[model samples]
Target: MFTLSSEDNTNFTELLKAVHKIGSKTIAKHAQDVDQKARFPVESFAAIKSLNLMSAYVPVKLGGMGLNVEQISKICEVLALYCGSTAMIYSMHKIQVACIVHHCMQVDYFKNYVKKLVSEQRLIASATTEIGTGGDLLSSFCAVKESDGQFTLTKKAPVISYGEAADDLMLTARRNIDAPNSDQVGILLTKEQFQLEPISGWDTLGFRGTCSSGFIVTASASIAQVNPVPFSEILSQTMHPFAHITWASLWSGICTDAIDNARKFVKNSVRRNPDMPPISSIRLAEVTGSLNNMRNNISASIKEYTEMLIIGDSDAFTNFGFSTRINNLKISSSQMLIDIVGKAMMICGISSYRNDSELSLCRHIRDAYGASLMVNNDRILMHNATLVVMHKEAR
Candidate 1:
């Protein structure tokens, strides 16, 4: 039986060592350029490809290294330390991949695709939100058109991160033209199965390497490509909590960089003054404490999620209390990420304000701001508000 646990992470230590090697040298080198140009971090992706980490989280039965959520979250955090865009891109890919492993593997097509990952470094992207839906992922304006085991769909996606560049895209669509907006299915589409027409620009505050521009996604696939289960059930079981853990891992990574810079600045300030501690030292201490909490909360979520996976707790996936906790995890981590990055900038003072300075957080701050708005925490908070009253309190 496959199991994921913090206690079992020793299995992937060497793999992580390899990831760190590439990160410190290659991924770290391109962080500034990737952000400045607002282009895809080709080098980071290449490093991931070279190391074959695209399959790192994939199971050994499928020719992958088969690391679990706890180990994979560590990889996401480590990548964020070098480049937030790279980390975000990696986290999103893993979330999609997790769906295949945890839910879709019973389908022969998804299982074969996993085996193919060993030889083909295919990148996966997701399209869950459509422009016509008013930010509601549960509804879809794009309905799947099907005839004789053939299916096709088109959607004006508000954003498709790394869309044009992805080798495969997993999308959601109404089950059929006549089906209700909420009757949806998830489909696995290869590049040959789809065409993308650019719709909007991607110049943004941060996460530029993601290349998350708007586009018209037209895709066609066979029935085998469609998930055998309902999209809503799959989202609840796999995508939601998986996204939270991976995304929050990256946020913790960004916070790790911020606190490191803040501490370095304070240590230097104390050395220079020799007699008095800097006024900002107190804030540094406070933020450091908060950062610890932030990391702990994220880690605990990953662990809880891992345990949930281990037991194959299908009922737990739909439980309101579990869903609320998962939703709140994303909200809290995103907001705290901005707060920590801002404080780091204050600690670095004038230097961090300047983009050219050694201690500058110009990129970090921009990337941090993108976290809360990525999935929109306000929307999540609103959803939780509707559920909080009904969510049973934990024993």
Candidate 2:
């Protein structure tokens, strides 16, 4: 129900209000159960599907809401206020939608597919990481074999979040048998076209509702399923920035909720004393400051990325400077979630540590840890080290 500004579009503001209603009334109710069971947030997703937001990033001409990354990122942030797993699933889904809409929509088949996606409210998942690749998203050990206008691929993915629940899977593989591991193409395969043989379970400390299990994904589809855009271009232009920004937005939401609880704890202690403010209030102030900085950092990155896209600054997206900033945003925001939540736990004391307490941060703290491991901060830092050396200038 919150509008970013008075200048925001009236219709989208109403849409966001509707999303907030769903988040508070539906998603939050089932979040605990979903986490406890280590299962997908089916109830949360059903509410989301009711809004027909799956194609939010698709063009309006393609029969979607035609939302940009900023608006979609806001939605992710709002959803995370209620449930991190649901928010993360939605964020990942939108990232895949952006990939297809921005890169593959030039092809008629994918164009129609987006339209169909809008109509059906289909969910999409990605298989970008392979078992042998060691979490390197750009490399692929599997190849798409093409013959007689049909192509087939089999991948050993270490993790495919909600693969069983998705209506479609967008996977990466070498363009052909002769192509190198890095010469990859994204292939869109429907549920009917792919079979996932589970290779690992989803038991985890947090984000359990994501069901990010390992799988052997075997798929066959028309050769037309191969996207026209290069995988590297999609990776740099859409995947990297979108993933980092939306993810940071969601993590910000989680941190905000945790801080809100800390505020409540401090307020209660102050009410009990009635003479002087509790020392925990100082900790609350510190965490709130960090939260504000985290939010501002994410907002600045969002603004920069949005402006670059508006001006058709294609090179900036792939440039070392922007890439480094985006990577830093991910690193800082991920760490801040832990820092803010840990501080909240310290401020709230036993209440925040207890699973049954109203101010419990157990779920929030566990979920915050997953942010650092999503793509591994150390790997990104290593890449950034090389990027800084190559670029040699900061904006």
Candidate 3:
């Protein structure tokens, strides 16, 4: 059994140390090349799995670490700083494991799966987002009907991470075949039992190495288990927090990366040209402070939300609180990093844009654009907030 090293201290610190020791050293350096070639970071994944970090959140009774969400978020934040693609892959796996641990009816199967994942260093990811559905899992147009206790999931999931590499995929589909527009749905686990013909390639401007490809599910497979309730409720209640924290951590890591690169550029410029303007020094301080503030806010929010989850108060509404906060943080971090990177580019002049500088703020900018598009976008979140305030006023 993997015992978490931190008994009295915050688990986040320990998680950071573990990732550092697990050989995530060249993740950032390799990120550009991987993104350029659209190749998966196989070495990084292998290193993470070898350290059993992939099974960090599975219950210890199941021969896993059983760490909490706060710990997992810390590890994710660290990984994101190095490689956004690797961080995303790991986050999806963690979300799937958390869902199974909390909702699976077959306890034996769940335990055995965790054991196998830990022992064999296997990974799982989500294939829930559909191309036509517009990234909303609750409002998926994908249909799954019950015919002799077997469910067939048919949908075109675009931008699914690790589409061909995942050991299993947590897929969501609507059960209301008679009513195609109804929100009644359930989650089903599909093992490596289907084909993943890449319908669309993943040559994106950012997060390129994520291997987020579009594929179609053509065959009917055995349904592992269903939530026994509406899928929307399960997603809003159980899955939202996982998504929020994971993505928030990723953005936070990217913010750190931007800051580090900016600092290096400024420091080198100052070293070479000692007579540089004081404004450059002031701008560097401002950007560094902004990045630090965003990182602290995200880390604190993850800790608070994790406590709520562990205490069993993770209902849809309560979970939304953390979700909204994370969303806000994502937006703020992206904007800040973009401005900081732009300033850094000016400081470094044409050299920053050169291929040899290895300073690709372009990828970060694109990935940041996609971040705001995740789940509830800015307008939707604002509307939700308005509804809440109006409800409180009526009360």
Candidate 4:
């Protein structure tokens, strides 16, 4: 049964232990370097793969441990506490696996691939978001054309996490040739067949290590075979909630880390001066409390959202409600993290601002701010939520 509480639960305990072993020190040491150079965290991915963490979402039927969303969320939180970019990349791969499992009825090749991923410890990454389409992931500027029972695609993905290094890419593209607003989207995988066309446009302020560079794909390359049914499902349902929960979990971890650093700094200051400012101490406590509150709220939201998804009502309105809640949580968590980090910076003074601190409160503040802006912007999401409510009320 592979119970989490059981001492002999090798998969559960080992997964946690592997995350700590692979992520803790290496992420702390290289996070700044990766951010500064805007390089992908290759070593972190290597470590994660070594622990078979990348295959966590592959179902038990497919020979994977098949952990649930809550378990995966915990693992993500642990990793994000060390490095946000690494966590984001890793989460995306997991989402890819979940998408594959949920959508396909024929499991022969999919199960084989899952077993191979676990045995070989290979990583898969999503190559979805594009430059021209903005955040409308459903409509990709990329398109797939079929000839002689084979498919080829021409794509220009703007931000593919682990784009340069992944073993395989699960990409989305429009299939219809004539219709501009085609609902027939195809999800395809490309092995080592494609080349990374030179992309000179990857300078970002935060989560720099994401290596979120753009690439152009030509039709000459052979597209790896993919099952479109699961792929499309991934785009609509699995990807969105997975993204929300993963990012929210990361933000929660970062918030906790910031609170811990702030507490340590305050304690040190008080030790140095028998009478540190009373207001400083009070503010630290308040920030800590606020962070805790945000964590609880996000955790609860994730639980509720997951339950809704598992209940499996395919009503369009129900899906919107789930997505709206997820979006709100992301916004709320980002704000809380910003507040905590900003206060910590004030408390820790110029030292926290310096690049040498293991905590890197300044970098986190910037990263958190950027995350809040990406995909569905917090302000826009709030507006959408209001409209949804209004539409429901009128009905």
lDDT of each model, Cα atoms only? Answer: 0.87, 0.90, 0.67, 0.69
Q: List the residue pairs that clash in candidate 4.
A: none
Q: What is the lDDT for 231 in model 3?
A: 57
Q: Which regions of candidate 1 fall more than 4 Å away from where they truly are?
A: 1-11
lDDT of 2 by residue, 269-331 (tens): 998998998999999999999999998999999998877776765666788989999999999
TM-score of each: 0.95, 0.96, 0.84, 0.87
Q: Report the number of the highest-TM-score candidate.
A: 2
Candidate 3: the clashing residue pairs are none
Clashes of each: 0, 0, 0, 0
lDDT of 1 by residue, 237-331 (tens): 77899899889988889998988988899999899998998998998999998889888888888878778878876787888888899998899
The weakest ten consecutive residues by lDDT in model 4 span: 1-10
| Model 3 residue 283 CA deviation in Å | 1.0
Ranking the candidates on TM-score from highest down gives 2, 1, 4, 3
Better of 2 and 3 by lDDT: 2
The candidate, 1 or 3, that scores higher on lDDT is 1
Order the candidates by lDDT, highest first — what do you get? 2, 1, 4, 3
**After aligning candidate 2 to the native by TM-score, how far in Å is the CA of 312 from where it should be?**
1.8
Report the lDDT of model 1 for residue 12.
74
Q: In terms of lDDT, which candidate is strongest?
A: 2
Question: lDDT for model 4, on a 0 to 1 scale?
Answer: 0.69
lDDT of 1: 0.87
In the order shown, the candidates' Cα RMSDs to the true structure are: 1.9, 3.2, 4.0, 3.8
